[model samples]
Target: MWPRGDDDIIRSNSLHESWSTGALNIDMLFPTDYFLFQVAVCSALLSAVSPLRPAYSTALENALRNELFVDRNYSLLQRPSQQVDVRVSLTLLTVNELNVKDQFLSESGYLSFSWQDSRLSWSNTSATSQDYSNIDSLFSTELYVWTPALIIENSIQDMSVISDTKIPMRITQDGWVFWSPSGVYKVSCESDITYYPMDTQTCYLKISTWGYSKSEIGLSLEIGTPVDDSFYRENGEWDLLSVAGHPPIVNARKGTWYSSLGFSVTLRRKPIFHVINTLFPVILMGFLIPMVYKLPTDSGEKMGYCLTVLLAYAVYLTLISDDIPSTSKTVCLLSVYLGLTLTFSTVSVNIVIYILYAHFEGDKEVPAWIDNGVRKFGRFTRREKRDQNKVKPSTKEEHCDDKKLTAILENEENNNEEHKPITYREYSDILNTFFFVLYMAAMIILTIIFLLPLLINYLTNG
Candidate 1:
């Protein structure tokens, strides 16, 4: 057949006459059929788009259709055997986000997995999809393969849906299965804060089937080797101690068994940062307790200094309390120690008040108790006591010649010098010296008794 030219195609052949000059002419291209040409081009484009796939390969498609693709609707456990035994394993990528304050740990990892479905199997002798990669080289036709819907049972409370996938999976003729799924999950963990800031915790990752119980789909864990050091990256916040998964546990509810696997993730907190930021400052402020007694009441800063230190302690307590839950089952040991220090600080303030009052008692005769108490606790030697008690004559040779005396007065008739009154300054000096020694002794005893034990435990175990 000859190709039809545009002239052979239909076009308007009309004679046109100019109205003004009355000249006759013939036009051929007028009223051309562009609508017909447009329909022809569209038909060509549609034919290119929907190319014939392997489904149209009647020999292969018929082979697979007879042997493999017949069963689209059947029971979930499509097996000749009574039970579908499915074993699951895991390959960890990382554990990135751990929120101690929220009591949940976020894990990013995938499942190393396989399963069996006998219904979707056939002979692979005469097929293009014999090899796994060959299935890709063939036309875009993967037999719709259904996979199990698994889930994490012990995940965070806020999660409404469990982490999983729903895409159609693969099925081999030999009934071997393979699928790997990765996700980031926040598993709930209850931390023990008995030694907290220096504490170790064990969090669990649990896996189980979402709908089916063990009677339908039996679950098993292949706990081959414990987690290696290189399995997870080193975290600045925690040190991974060991990862262990226990044997499958069977749970029976309403006369049916449910199977699941439990993995324990053991970790110890890196506490050097906690020690420096939260603990050292508290301890340093506590040591200043001794200086409160040593400050002379005359300077009027002794009370003010004590209150300021107390206020600082209050701020530290507030900061720590915000980090640690008030409703926690186990309280931190550092918090306990801080509470004890605050108690001691309050006692010091009381002691300061009493001493200041006694020192300023004006012109009252020195009580006998005061003299005995000063001598007993103030470290005055026997010679010093005797010299203090003796009367000195007006004559220079009879007196203990201490020229540091600020004042001297003479009697009118006998020209004898009067003895000076005992001053508040003198009593304050004696009290300050005595209490400084007392506070130091108490601090040493408390350190040995209360604080050392905790420090030793951390050194041995941390």
Candidate 2:
């Protein structure tokens, strides 16, 4: 008889009743056979009503682990094959910062690396009677498995190999291994600041197999989009234009070939920030430079005004210079514009000094050439006004009065043989008017030449 515990007392009583009710005929079996049948029936019923036993997941994992890695000699430094082809892909997460002055790009992302290992492959029931066919994959780490050593080719930060034993690597039943590791990566990039705030920069994130030759471990991108930006967050100061992956490039050095894959991130400056903060002010000051001549000489702010504008241009140039690398390979157009405007301000200051000297030179006779030029310009303007006002005389009386006035003017001109010379004040006034118009025209032309292209680019591409 099977031993019964207090927990099975109720079940035993129910079974006795079922037997007494003739559910099983006692005469149909012999005494020993009935006892054996009772034991068999009770065992089956207990098993059917009992709670489920623990699964064989841990056992299957232990078996698979022992079969695959226990004695497989999977060395981290060793490749699975002499020529293992690694499939590499990148997914961009965030464009943290791009330092134009330092010529570097900082970003956060992960890399998906996949390759096959023939040694780790196994059938579903290789180690036990239980069918582990439901198990699709297994997990391991770099500590106990062989993984390709891939690294950023142009990294500026940590140059060490990527290895984290804590991160689990997925291994499939068919020996396919997939590993994804993520971190912040910084890479060297060439900055082209020619258009400056209106520029579009393409920076590359390059990857390579470290310590492995191109023949030892080939690198290829997956067939789909290799550089995925589906999870990208927009940068406030920059707009992402495109992200593209390039085919593997075979590079040779010192009689050795290395394989590298590249992904290009094209970004354009948002321009609104720079336009309001930098370019707009520079332009506004360019126009303000001509106003120095408009201020009265006696107001005592002529020199101060000119110096103030020169100082403003200097400050703006310094500010913009901080954003670009100090490289001679390319010069920013905005810098050139600022320099030219600064020079114009300097010229205006010198002109102010000269004008003050003329104003203080009391009663000085203007030179013959100066007096003649000023008088000729003044007379030409007056003559044009007179012609516009003149009209034909309609009455005989008006004609006689016009003839009389003409005769009197001719006699007065003949009598005044020697006229007074031009004064210093008049010469100063002439110089002021001429330079005001000249400077205004110059400022407008400079805006059109240096700044129009920037505006056009901003409008077209913003």
Candidate 3:
């Protein structure tokens, strides 16, 4: 019913129809149609390529061995031997979006990436779908070939580049790529964000990719909102993302990147200590020196020793100030020392005044008005009473004789005693050297406890 060439075509058409229609009659009439049709197709292919069979067979075997046809189903009729070239590339971009949730501090920025496949289309003269698909395969198979770099740029003069050389990039089914170089970044202070001296301004991060591809290379950056975690990292590790880069410039400055990730830190001014050391010892010692005034003036060591403490405090003040910074805001513990020293000097001055007054006035009993008002209100009641009471009256008549006469006699006696002052040896037993030693000990202890902490806080914080 059909010609020879038409017979093969008719047979192929009938077989296809029976297969598609699932005909029960074909199963009985042509039980071997599927097998026969496959044989006929193989015979025709072999006859048509018989002259180049060897060349074609070798090429087909090479392609299969090379895994070029792994995605195709193979049959005896026709063997595919075509191979495509896949090209790939990766690019990194810097992201500059502010993170609103955070105060622009912790987790301030991260790396992100954009991936593109060039093997989606096949072409020799120009890139085709096959070329894109092949390029994508390279990405899928060689996920470890990608690396990321972060480029930081801002309005400030100092911009730093943060790099994590150990990035591992992997492509997902949808062609999205991801990676992260975990760490916090330190951005320079900005003035526009806040007026405070230490206010942190705007900062951003970008994600990028690095790799060895030519055609299929691409990168994308996502701008992150500013955040505030300036103190420390909330999570132990940096979050994972793609290509990371710095945000846009808010205020630029000269900057370099240091490899610390825990917190953003800054330096403060150091505290001065010279004044504190000098004054504290003097004041503490000075307070106790007044106690020495309680001793009789006849005691040779009282004034001399008090004078020595005053001089020592002055010397300490001068020495300590040399080491302190002139512009420091905090009052040095040394200043406290100096204050104490000056206070003791004042006490010494009081002692000197008391001794001079005692020596020049003689043992005349003080006048009732002088005793009740001036001496009592002037902070010298005890000394005045003791000095005036030492001399005895000759008689009741002499004591009551004209009050003026008594006063004159007392003055003459006080002047005579001043003219014949007591020697240091005669009053040595009355002097208490132990009080001076105790004063020094208290000062040392107080300095150690109070001054040390202030100094430590100043130095550490500052």
Candidate 4:
């Protein structure tokens, strides 16, 4: 009734001293004052002993106790009914890893299941009479009640019914039970790496009633959005595009119908890391394949350059092999592009060796094909140059003088000025130019065919 402070303690101490010295009279104090004094003494004693402890509300406790006691004999082994519908939803938290080679995906999330149990129902009037009107729900461990055993149908882990005693179930007054348990799930996913680094994968998380048939336990998503990603952690290698839930599939076996619900998760590969580590280097090496022709045949580095690029491609192919599963159902276009580039490099090396032989150990007369090709190429080039330069053609007198000069040079076999015929060395030069244009064009075409889709997807999706 009154604020107790240092003043109260001083007053009490003074009274005690007076009483001890016989200087105070109890008759002088009023009945109200005497009662107040007694109250102050008790307060002081209690404060000296320990601080006041907080009292908890018993409504929630009583509700939980009553619910658990009533369901103490509830058999978790039995189904609630022959037609219990369980609404299941998923909350995706993390995309830990998706092993392409193992064909399995690892993820951590929560599975929420809600259904009605007729035996667990109670009246609101009873709860209100028990002083638990504010407490609308009671919680009990999952092991204490019957639960629809929903198992991951495509799980690669132990195919057991999900049970976590530590996780509790929420039960309302109207027998509606809601249970949500979180765990790491590893499920089988058939990976299609046809586009590889720039590929988009659609993985599914399939759920089914383990022991109960469709007639006993049916699954559905009452909510519009069944798969939630509000708490999803971003994965470094893959970008989650969309998550969609599908209705349970009804299949009949031996006159028994079963149901399975699937959640489709579409994930696109993040091309930046793979591009820098694998694709960029492979493309860079591909460009080097055509550069082999630019080197002069006499430089003796042409063959070496081709072989070096070819070896680099071989190493890249081996590296890619580790990332993708070995299956012949479908081949990756990236691998095919690399194989084609490698083949071009090998053919270039062979052609170079042949050119070298022709240049060093061939006869004086050039091959007819080479000669004709060279002459035609020269004529086309000279004609273009002449047109571009706007130069006048040679006159009749000049033509006659050129003919007489050519005859004199042909007749003089012992002349000191020796006239050299077109040789294989010239042919090698022409072939080098031809090969340069050919392989560079091939590289460009291969890049467009293989990597262009990746670029388009990355840009469009990102």
Every candidate's lDDT: 0.62, 0.79, 0.39, 0.77
Residue 181 lDDT, candidate 4, scale 0-100: 91
Question: Candidate 4, residues 64-129: lDDT per residue as tens digits?
Answer: 456545534566776777789999898999888888888888999989899998666654444432
TM-score winner, 2 or 3: 2
Which candidate wins on lDDT? Answer: 2
TM-score of each: 0.67, 0.77, 0.31, 0.75
Q: Residue 322 in candidate 3 has what lDDT?
A: 59
C-alpha lDDT of candidate 3 relative to the true structure: 0.39
Q: Give per-candidate clash totals.
A: 0, 0, 83, 0
What tens digits encode model 1's per-residue C-alpha lDDT throughout 196-234?
677777888887765677777677775464233355677
Candidate 4 residues lying further than 4 Å off, grouped into runs, are 1-73, 124-134, 252-255, 369-421, 460-462
| Candidate order by decreasing TM-score | 2, 4, 1, 3
Better of 3 and 4 by TM-score: 4
Looking at model 2, the pairs that clash are: none
**Residue pairs with backbone overlap in model 1:** none
Q: Which is the winner by lDDT between candidate 2 and candidate 4? A: 2
Give the 10-residue window scoring lowest on summed lDDT in candidate 1: 409-418
Q: Is candidate 2 or candidate 3 better by lDDT?
A: 2
